[model samples]
Target chain A: MCELLGMSANVPTDICFSLTGLVQRGGKTGPHKDGWGIGFYEGKGLRIFHDPEPGIESKIAAFVRKLPIKSEIVISHIRKANRGKVELKNTHPFVREFWGSYWTFAHNGQFKKIKTEPLGDFRPVGTTDSEYAFCWLLGKLKKKFKESPQPESKLFETLEILMTELHQKGVSNILLSDSKHLYTFCSTKLSWITRKSPFGKATLLDADLSIDFRKVTTPGDRVTVIATNPLTSNEEWNLYKPGQFQVWKKGQIVFSNE
Target chain B: MCELLGMSANVPTDICFSLTGLVQRGGKTGPHKDGWGIGFYEGKGLRIFHDPEPGIESKIAAFVRKLPIKSEIVISHIRKANRGKVELKNTHPFVREFWGSYWTFAHNGQFKKIKTEPLGDFRPVGTTDSEYAFCWLLGKLKKKFKESPQPESKLFETLEILMTELHQKGVSNILLSDSKHLYTFCSTKLSWITRKSPFGKATLLDADLSIDFRKVTTPGDRVTVIATNPLTSNEEWNLYKPGQFQVWKKGQIVFSNE
Candidate 1:
């Protein structure tokens, strides 16, 4: 198993606050210490930083904690070796390009016999079950949609079906994004919190830091954060039931499998 | 124009010393300050750090300089943004996965009508002639070789021919690597230097720093550094002629168009 942290916002936002709490679990407060990675998307530009080191000890993760790289979408993960060797290739937050957009995926649960499926054009560079599932999912999507930039609703429906297929095999808790939208599927554990104009103060569960969201954000700002577990103790985190899937855009939940 | 930096080594070597010099060119020493990026290949795992911010001032670049992530192949670029906007996607070096290996490319020159070429299976995530040319090149190779993991010699020959096609159109000075081989092609300015057993001291032209290679390296180590210009003032660098293509593996030149 691994840990995942994701963010979506109406305005460009940084994940330093959320990341600080989650990275603690990477080797400090928790046991996931194999490796970690994160990706930030600015429009069509996707910037990724991967380190085959524990996130708590990684200098790059420390840099990320200090620097406020504002982005509309972000995904991060801290992994514990299970089905794959602990290496840079097996680091979480895997990416593949399709339909002229870079798609990012990070998973958090063990799966059984997922590699038995055939992959199309996209192949996994890493020998991880997480990467294998991503390639398989993307290949299925690409095969169905001969032309890309597909209608959002159509794409979302197809994605849910694909997620269900993976769910049939084993735990498939995942956070994925295609620059424009973020899709999160929960097999067992996933939680989220959305902050809007009337945002108040919040404190990190693992760290001693606290922030008053109102001080930094405007009245029109909206932000949503998702993770395998609640990162903050104060916020009202909405937990997902098993086999739940949700899609987000512009900081709002557009669709879901209720 | 932009500044390109690349390395090939018989052993896993860090490019920190050379990167310290090249990054200075991002703003302090040169005018190519739009953006910068670097990719390091460790086996099949590629770790990349991209910043639309100038490398000289980027905290990420600063972190990269201090942390030594050793690798056998590296490609770094500081861009001036001639053909595309100063953004993350347009920042070199651009990467795409093909033949189950991560391919990295960095360009130092511009092209006129490179975008007019048709892209197959791969598309540019950014609006840049360099990315356009890379997709075009890789797509052609993929078409010819239906199966991946193609013979090294065959792939090298096909790549040389594809590079010639780009050279015919306009400036296509590029540094490309597919984990196993580093392919360099020059349409204008490009140079290289190889250091081996009897390594000597070298001084950077852009910074007031020097390294005595004999103190840090063993006689069994061999390293090849390539750049748009001579990065060090004290070292003897070999300049490539226009339309020349060379392939390097394990820090040794395997083939050339000489």
Candidate 2:
């Protein structure tokens, strides 16, 4: 199994404090230390870095920690090879291009020997079932729609049907983003937190670091975080029900079908 | 290390299809499956599940695959032992409570020998660096603000300074949420995708799946996905620059300091 982390906010915010604690699990504080990766969104563009070494020891990881790049959205992961080899090619949080835009995805579970037709346009670069499923999803979307995008409600309906079909195949806990909004679905375990005005104190469980939300945030700011686990010891982290899915935009819950 | 997956949208959406592909990596397609977990937000509450086995083989994972749970925000993860032994206690995606709200986190990196003060309100049940970091972050927020949350810009600035300090110690890529908005920071790698009107075909890079945006989404629907890597084969995946951070809210980029 692996860990997951994500963020959404009403204003541009930095996740350095929380991220510092999370990274320790890559090789130092946790056992995930197979490989590590991260993604940040700056406007419509995304910046990414990945390494096959434990994040605790990787020089690239060190560089990232020292930098303070900022964006409106971000995603990241560390690898613990299971079916695929522990090479750079098999890292999590795969990226692709669609409709002249970039799409990013990361997974935290596995699928057994499931086979599906390959779309001519989408294919897997690695030999992971996770990648295979991504291609299949793209294929379905392309086959169903051709040119214009559908409305949010219609799209949600279509996705609901497709998600149901895919869930039948195997374990599926996923996070997806296009630099604007975020979407997620859980088959097993997941959790989340939201930070807004009247911010309170938050304490890390991995490190001794602590921050006062009142000192950092204003009444106008709102932030939501989703992860495979809770990052803070003092905050209330909500758990996802089995077989649930959601979509988040800004700092509020814009859509859900759980 | 660990893997992370998340989704945000302008409206509620199901992650069934994408999750199916992602879970395969937890122990089937990849090697993260030391344990699996996921979280979904429905209204103000959250649904969560966890398994101490490969998500592909776990009954819980299977149930999630077939279930139609949905929300506007979601988070998920699979574990790869890096710190503590493989057990239910060492799963990714930790959760907690603060200010009458749930806070969740997941991480994908490692920190070196980092030491901090113990949080007064938060403590770790597991011995993972990821958890420690969560506690430290929350503690700092509490100390800085005491009770009232600051503005988003102020929070972001404070985070920037704190992240820079942590980067000095080791690698850190993280995601934090409060069920409303998300905050992400990358010390190493990260990527994202946004789907909206003028949608097109998307091919998965890992699996043989494709989806046509025209059939599933509306012109009014906008979604963003962030990950350590790209998930599609036919879509352009943007990479995060080193030391970058961002905030996601309302299906748009509200603030970025990249």
Candidate 3:
């Protein structure tokens, strides 16, 4: 098994608080210690950091935990290496450019023989079933919408159908983004929380740390955090039922199949 | 204009010493201060860091400069924003995956109105002439070589033709890599140096830093560094002539059109 963390914000925000807790599970609190990767979007430019080392001991991971790289959409993963070997090429939160937009995806579950399907233009550089699925997802989208752009609702509709089909294969708990929206699908375990005005203190579940959101955030700020498991003990997290798909934007769920 | 720095080595090697000097040109030593980026390939896995801020003052740049991350191939750039706005999307050292390998590219010079060419599957996430040229190059390759992997000689020959076409459009000093080979084409300024058994001391041109290769490297290691302009004043560097293309492997020029 693996883990995933995602954030969407109305304004540029940092994931340091949530990241601190997640890194603990990468080795200390959990067994997902093979490697880790994270992606943050600053406008259309996406910055990705991949370390094929345990996040608990990686120097770059520590550097990222302290650096205040702000982004409107963020996705992260810690791997346990169920389907692929523990290597940099197999690190999660893979990114590819499609339709003039940078899309990022990370998976938290395993599947077999997912590569049995024919591929389009996108190909996986690694041997992970997760990456193969991502390539399939993006390749299908690129082929369907080859021209300019498509309406968000139409795209979401297409994605829902695809996700439903993919969920039938195996566990498909995934977090994906197309630079404009954060799309999450629940096949097994997933939870999410949104923070806005009147934010209070929240304590981490995995680490010995806590943050006073009222001191760090403005009233206008709205942020949504989605993860495989709840990272905080105090905050109320909404659990997603199996086969549910949600599209989030500006820190809130804009569309959902609950 | 902008600046480029690349490395190819038989053994995994850290580029911190060379990157330290190149980042200085981002703002402290030169005028190419719009943004900066670098990609390091650990096997087929690539780790890329991009900053829209000037490298001189970027905390992430500072972090990357000190890290001991090693790679067999590396590509980096410092931008001056000739044809695009100063944004993260427009940063240099753009990457795309093809043929089950991550290909990275960076350009030193630029021209406007290059998007007049019809694009294939690959599209530019940023509105930079450099990225547009890269997409065209890769899209052509993906279309022509849609089967399995082609022979390296055939691929290089195709690249040489594409380089000639792109060079005709503008000043196309570029450093590109397909994880297996480092490809460079010089329309104007580019230089390279190969370090072998007889290690020597070298000094940076932009920073007050020096290193003795004897202390850090083994006798069997071979490394080649390529840059838009010579990075070290103390080393003997070979300058590439205009319209020359070189394919480098394991720190040596395996093929070239001198």
Candidate 4:
């Protein structure tokens, strides 16, 4: 019982608008109030802000909502603490380095028996099934391919297979990134929306705020946002069926298993 | 060259007072204006703030300086780029995970050819000699000890040997932590100060700031601050000799190579 938010953009973009709505679910409009974390990728460097406090009351989250830190890829999570104790170490959107790239992952559902899975080089610092699952996924990737596999399709295929295994364990809706692409596997609930040319005004579902994309974005700007639930009431969001796997690059879906 | 700052405390303590003076050196008092970063350890979790902008003017740095986020261990850096371009990826205070602990590293000197060193599992996300050296060191440790080594002294000795090799290459002042101990290696310059029961007032060297440690601390609290150069003007500081390696725990020096 958590919430996830992710973004991929053709240009560096901020998630303040989406994040403003998501933070409401952290405490105000919903019950996911244990802790919150967000990761923003600025080139190859990743900056993460983690607060054990409820996101609705987090000073850091307020600062982040106001300060527009632009990034090509972003991952964020608000926790309800189903598998681990509420602490800074158990905050979601966990990160690790593999093959010279920073990989970030956020999960929105539970896995019953992920802890029994063995880990290799990557180990979880916290006692969360979500983190254990991330380490397990990354360790499998590292073991199967000594280096980043060439002809990216091979890597995508491997990810699909691994994600399928995780889905079999339990509800495992995931949003992951390898600095270059955003990979998503939905076990239960997920939705996404892409804004490109002719972008119009949208109102937040949780708050009384509206933004006209035409005023802020250029025609060339393309941005994709994925979340466990729709953040905007006006915008149309595409729902993913269960067991769907997708790879997104530059705000567009490059591969998908329907 | 860059500037480094670190802290180890017997109790959870804030480094805002020390960081206030150090950030001034990022552009106002010294030449390290390329970027800045700091990591604060909260139990087993770590929170880091990195800015490619100069610390003197960075909004993030200003917010961090005002927030009294207490931590038991801290590592920070202000960079003056030499080998790498001025970008977020090349900012100081790099991080990696090993043996279920997050290891953070910040370097204050140069390595002439450290990039040529071979690596095993750990890899650098940025193109910096300091990060290369960290990768090489951690990779060697992972290779030698399958798990965390028993008998902590053995790990310290192994670190000393690895750091000596780094010192041979060039100037390699380092501050590293694995959520437990603060490991320091000095090639040319480093200093430390410990404050306990008899707290006194101190004045900053780079900023118009003064703090009375008596007003903020209790008698049982012991705190150690390490930096490339002493941060305060009035406090007496202990200087590390060239090629010195030390391990610190709970504000006390556990082992040192004098």
Candidate 5:
């Protein structure tokens, strides 16, 4: 099993504070020390770093901690081998190009006996069920929608139907984005927190770190963070109901249907 | 390294569509197939799943693909070995209880030569620096605000300073949450997207998938997603600039300083 961390903000921001606390779990406070990767969105582009080493002890991780990369959206992961050899190719937060945009993906669950036909356009570069699923999904979407782009509502509806079908096979919890919006679904555990103008204090549970929101943000800024679990001790985290799904855009909930 | 996925929305929604595509990366499309884990925030609690197998081939992953777990917030991760022998103990998305609330954390990146003195209350259960960092952060937060919670502004100010110091040591891209608000910092790469009533078509770059947002969401809903990279091929993704910090609350950016 692995862990997940993400951030969505209206203004460009760095995830250093939350990441500082979460990175500790990679090897110090928690287990999950296998490899680690992170990606930052800069306008229409992405900056990514991946390492086949424990984040707590790897030099790459140290470099990342020190670098100050700011963006409106961010995604990160730490590895714990479950399938495939521990190598660079097998790292999470996989990236690919499509429709002239770079797409990245990562997973934290296993799928059994779930096989899909070889995708003509998209193929697996590695041998993990997660990759296979990604290819299959892409194939399905391409098949369903040709050249014309659909509206958000229609797109979400199709996704909901597809998700329901996929969930029938096994457990699935996921986070996805294309730089414009974030989508999430849960078959198990997932939590989130949002910060706004009426800021307050937040104490980290994994580390003895605390932050005062009032000083860091303005009245107009809004931020939403999603994780597998809560990261603070003093804040109120909103837990997703079982079999729930939601989407976030611009620091606010855009769609939800549990 | 592990992979992370997250979503936030105004209305309840499922991430099955995105999860399906992401799952493929766990073991099929890309790599990251050592073990997988997921967390879904349900109301005030979280539903979680951890599997010590490739998500593409694991039975649980298959089942999850079809599950309909829904939520306003979601987080997921896939693993690839980097530290600690591959086993359940080393999985990511580590959970802890603090201030009567469940906190979760996930890290991407590595740290080296971390020799910070061990704190009193928090300690590492694993040899990974990630856990040590978590403990250190928690310990620091506890020590800073031992008596009462400070204003969010004050807390964030202190955290910013601490994060800047920690960043000087290593690569640190992280996500942390207490259910109400999310904190993010990027020492490296991270990206995000937001969706609202005027949703449009989104195509997956890793897979041949696309969604029409207009079909599934209401006009009042908004969603935000953050990741290490973008997941779609046609949508615009916002990247974090170098050396940035920010906070998210209620689906909007609350504080930011790049």
Candidate 6:
């Protein structure tokens, strides 16, 4: 029903190349044209741009595309509204602050009756089932751990259990980040690719553009990008299995429920 | 010290003219050049743009100045960075969600030893005293009222008491909003002007730009602009006294401690 694009990197990086490909799907290459939003995490601070306009047609999106605002974590979404009306409030990705860190979430699929779930301290400002689900998940997390859980693996395990419940509701492909890591849960479609020292030229599947990663990146730079669909035609994107959950840190997959 | 600019209007209005003047203070006209941020409220949705660069030189700031994004409520800040480092996380115009509404805050003055205060559910993502004060204030409010206070006046009264506590800590000139209303607390410098029917031309004090409000607005339109200093040279702005608080709705002063 929508598209999600996310990036996690060992160093501050820009998603302009990948974003250019994905935004094409927002209107020109695909039908998801209701609205779009993106969040870029710079250190502990997160800057988000939200527009209730077709990503391909938005001036803000154009500015974002042209300007390379570097960040270690980024999440973006292009919407085809189903549960919520096409409005600025309903646009993804949504954000909430937790444990003194900003957590950003974007959904790519639908959920049945997700709004009926109870929320804790976190509340949804928008009417989307996606936002309601995020609020429910984060509220539950906050209730479980008064602060960020020690032994980070425990947090991952709890997220797996909570996300599985959401998977049972319906298609629940999600991209979420908490400044330090990118967490992904897939119920249906999801794919990711990691580019490192041996980076080569890659052509976009949706747009008439190509980038030679070798020219722009250093040998030590590692960058991982996740999306609902593969953005590059030549890159070897790892497709996620249904009901899988993965956690990425510093451009590498540190945990996965394969 | 920093600069604050806020607007409350009966209808959706763009702050391009005022922003053009205020941004000059971010570097060219004044010394507040550490960072800048602005939040524009569209219904229940909020769109924010943040730049760590001086507002006068920031490309993002330039784009924002040119874009006519209409909003009914707006909160903006240009920082001089006293309590925190000149980083994205330390930039002002902090936000938190309470009772399903997004509360945006922008401060113009420093709060000495404010971060020493205890907090509840809300936490500060950045090490700025201003953000810490916001978290403490909101956490206290959330603790007092599990939901938004039933009687709106009670919330206003409670805010006055809480803000008075902040005033005790140090200078705490703040412009805050919760979608429906703009709540301002002044410990030092703050000023406001309401433009209604029979509007006239207004010229910027910091810049050479001038706007004829009569040509752009209808008689039914009412807009209130709040700033750390009066943005226009020709208009009469009412200055706030120390320890003064005011609540604005539909561009009119609904509550005030004159």
> How would you encode candidate 2's per-residue C-alpha lDDT over B135-184 as one tens digit per residue?
67766775786543657677667766666656566677777676776667
State chain A's TM-score for model 2.
Answer: 0.93
Off by over 4 Å in 3: none
For candidate 6, write residues B1-258 as lDDT tens digits.
Answer: 999999999999999999999999989999999999999999999999999999999999999999999999999999998888999988878988889988998887777787677888899999888999899999999899988886799999999999999999899999989999999999999999999989999999999999999999999999999999999999999999999999999899888877
lDDT of 4: 0.94
Q: Tell me the spans in candidate 4 whose CA falls farther than 4 Å from its real position.
A: none
In order, the TM-score of chain B in each prediction is 0.98, 0.91, 0.98, 0.99, 0.89, 0.99
Q: Model 6: DockQ against the native?
A: 0.90
Say which prediction, candidate 2 or candidate 3, comes out ahead on DockQ: 3
Which pairs of residues clash in candidate 3, taking residues 3 or more apart in a chain or in different chains?
Answer: none
Global lDDT of each candidate? 0.91, 0.70, 0.91, 0.94, 0.68, 0.93
Candidate 3 lDDT over A1-258, as tens digits, reads 999999999999999999999999889999889999999998888999999899998898999988888999999999998888999999989999888888999998877678898888789999999999999988788788875355678888889988887898888999999889999999999999999998899999999898999998999999999999999998899999999999999998888887
Q: Interface RMSD (Å) of model 6?
A: 0.6
Compare the candidates by lDDT and give the number of the best one: 4
Clashing pairs in 1: none
TM-score of each: 0.98, 0.50, 0.98, 0.99, 0.50, 0.99
Record all residue pairs in model 6 with backbone atoms less than 3 Å apart, i.e. clashing. Answer: none
Of 2 and 4, the candidate ahead on lDDT is 4
| Share of native interface contacts present in candidate 6 | 0.86
lDDT over C-alpha atoms for residue A16 of model 6:
95
Instruction: State the TM-score for model 4.
Output: 0.99
lDDT of 6 by residue, A101-182 (tens): 9999999889988887888878999899999999999989988999888899999999999999999998999999999999
